[model samples]
Target: STGTMSAEELMKRGKRHLSVALKEECVNKNHVNLNIVLDHLLSKNKEIDDAETLEWCKSIIAGDKTYKEFLEIVKSYNNSSICGLVWTAEYVAYRCRTCGLSPCMSLCMDCFKAADHDGHDFNMFKSQAGGACDCGDESVMDAKGFCPKHSKNKDRSKIEPPKDLLFVAEIMIPRLVVRLVQYLRHSGAEKQYISKMTSFISFLQELSETGDLMQQIFSNVFTSQNDYTTYMISKSDVGVEYDIYEASLKFDTINVNKYFPELADDLIHKTLLDEMFFWVIKSKFPEHLVTFLLSILPNEQYKLAFVEVFVEHYRCMMVELTHSEDKSSVSNSVVHISVQLLSPLKLAIEIVTKFHLIHIMFACLKHIINQARYGNTLNLTSNVMKEHCYWPIVTDFINILAHPPIVQYFLNSTSLVNAWADVISSLQGLNMNRREHDLHVEFETETYYKAFSAELEICSTPLWALLKHLNDSSSKQLTINIVNILVTYLNKWFTENSVGEIEMNPDEMSFHYPLHRYLSLLISNALQQQGMELTDLLPSLEFLEILYLHPLHLLVREFFFFFVFPFNFVVGTYKICYV
Candidate 1:
């Protein structure tokens, strides 16, 4: 009796049973217990030789060998034996039968007296050794003794779902997979169940690879067994009574789209694009189709297909946007269209290998920004960005730039930096009327500051990465550009509120202090390495004088250089002179 014990507990108990069976020399008397022991042992210990154990167990059960001899015959097992043990069915030594409407059915002893299957005739036969009804006798009758329908009839609804999917004819194999994957997530299935379903779907997909059946199924899902039609209409005269119901009918027209106006012809296109982005979400297993597109080196044919699909979609949206005269619709659609266009590009930023790919992506972003700004430029009260909708894209792009891999790539690739910098410079110079300009001027400045601030926060600071590579004088211009960006960010942060004196929380120093600390370290290291005076590291002699004037700056500067500035002498000399 295994009872309700978990697998581990059963294994432990089975090990004890093996010890007893071996020690008592009772293998011939208790073949069932011996079988259970052997199965559990092989299941628990993979090293036990399964072939030897199976042969030995068979021999012992047949009374050809004693327990002591069988112990000596078996040696080890492999992981595969665990599976063999589970699938092997055991014979029931006793039989019980129930008088039911269908026929007499055999059950194991447990079901013979199970109170749930009441008001039925039962007969017990001892030591018969036959297979029991694996479904359990309860399936034939519920608690009230009513005949329960066979599962085929009960589960037909599930096994054969209604073939009522919209655009069912037009859906491709990849599109079907996308919807199913989405369904799997939306269904909230257990991880184990989802894994098994995905594995089965993968198998089906593999089978689809063999030839035309798959292509036909995908390309012509609307076709019935005999014809290519997808929808049917009544053919009997409207007033005539005829027995047309018995005749097999073929589909003639599709009007499901006409009923769903909110999602019209564009709905088909939107569904495809949305499903195409399964890889962007967390739960999706991207390797099969979605992930192939994400790879830095995808198959050239598939890559071209993906690019063409994206470009065509963009062209369609742009054409629609240009024809629309509604101001609010134009403004809202700009953000909406940009979101769709940029999402895949945003995902590619971290993984893209080629600098040329980055250039192309940035070019797309530049065009989107320019088009949005240009559309609303004439209307003084209108603005291009809706903060909630548009800023998320901007924030995501900032996060991508701040990613360590992307930042490291940017530092190493001069073209990547220059390309991105060109886009940033263009954003800064958007020409507009003063009234419209003032409305979003602050927001535009904040965006630039946000970009720089985000870039600096890579693994806590870009300053750390910059300092490590600063020794290479060839990247001096790149380093200067980054420093200038950071300085601009700091200046914007400091001058906010336009107060005469801006007070910063002493405890909040961790957020902003690292910038100054790393910069001071960078300057000190540059001066020491060049074997030149401070004047050489500073942009000009005037900047050197400001550093020389500030005692605190000198102290911080000397500290990173492993020394202390002597500030006590200046105060003491002043005191003596006054006396």
Candidate 2:
């Protein structure tokens, strides 16, 4: 019904409608067939990607208000002896659902045979055939359903993920929403569903805003509901249980982090930091919560709470000037705890704003890095950065800038990439040649090149500055992480957009370039630097190969799995071998 049809088939149908015009044009001396043909072509082919044909069709559509008006033009053309009556052109701009790539939508039957293949899914753009394309449908690119740009979106995942993550709390929210909706629709709960309470909780984001007493009530209810949903789904009878067992209601993209507002700075003074921090850190939050909180925060006082907590925690962890415990001691303890502590809270903060608590956290990082000199740096053999602290600092840059607006800011700012130079330069100026270049363009480009070069330097050496402190005890895990960051940087740069690809072109004669391509190519080339044997992490080219095609968006799950679970196993094995 879709790609199965040919351009000629389309023309035939269009021509069938045009035959009426042909007769009229033959009867008259006026010339109008060209306009009529274009009108018929556009009416029959709206999604066609043939650029030339699309323009001609548009021209015809523009010339006529109805089929009758177009028909009059076509009829007049036949009467004129020397007029060009029949003309054919191809439209260009049809794109694939799976890949977002618009290959060619023309009817080039003879030469480009590949264009006739199942390159586009006309069904996706249509209503009946598309049915209900859900989030799980990740088949746009080659290996994954995500776009080729997203196929290699490992860096995107680093955006820590909001606390109530859809992916993480998947079983919970949908079930709750389904249960709540069902219960509301049924006999007794219908009134409650229609009530304002239901309307309010439906958008229940941070319970903290409901006042202290209500906050306490909501905190318990929220946890209980999510936990119930979690247990229900984990057991596999979630549907029956939610439908018959209990009643409730609920529901909930983008470079979302940038626009999201920060939590109120008073979070430390007003709320129980310990209580709130745990929930934020205890589980990956649902996307609805992330979005709601983000939506509310731009104007509310809650963001102050978020910022305060982050600042205080980091102060507790690393601020030497504060009348607190030695910052380095905590940093050392976090490494030795054998638990992933920072990630969950970091995830929550990231969901709210990419740079929300960033300045605070980064200030803390600087303090921690400064204090690391005083800590009992671990012994190392060959591998450096084998400790826990190394991974968090290096891995989450993408999550830090997942929202494009922030990225646009980076590209706009003349400020140099002082810390994660490679990361900053890689995403800057992506798809933005159209935006007016700033007066500081020369400065921005120069600083961008410097940061890009610096990132390349980091890729080449000092990768395991902290890991090396482990005293030559090798870590396959840490090695993989280091390599993993580099690989992802390459993927984003190479596949992000045409401008990024151009900026990332390692061969460019221009001084300014995307940061990560050089890093990825060098990292791939110098695998020996990470101490990974040929088989450890996949080669960069292979990651690149499967990065942007169909079915591999599922690989994103694998990538996260590698991030979350592999470290434990890899670390366990490495430690055991040494023992």
lDDT computed for candidate 1: 0.33
Stretches > 4 Å off in candidate 2: 1-269, 272-274, 278-355, 374-388, 411-579
Q: What is the C-alpha lDDT profile of model 2 across 1-579, one tens digit per residue? A: 223334444345553343433333433442344334433443322322334443333232223224344334323222111111111112122234443221111111211122232544533122111111111112111333333222234333223322221121122223323333223223222222233223323333322232222233333333343443443345464345344323311100011122222323222222322223322221122222222322222121333444444434433332221212232333323221111112223333443344343444343434333333322221211112112233333222232333333333322332212334443333333221211223333334433343344333323233333223222214445334445555655455446544322322221222223343333443454454445446666655655443332112223223322344454564454345434
Best by lDDT: 1
- The CA lDDT of each predicted structure is 0.33, 0.31
Q: What's model 2's TM-score? A: 0.23
Off by over 4 Å in 1: 1-196, 204-274, 279-298, 301-462, 467-470, 492-512, 521-579
TM-score of every model versus the real structure: 0.30, 0.23
> How large is the C-alpha RMSD of every model relative to the true structure?
27.2, 28.9
Model 1 agreement with the true structure over 160-186: per-residue lDDT tens digits? 211221111122233233334333333
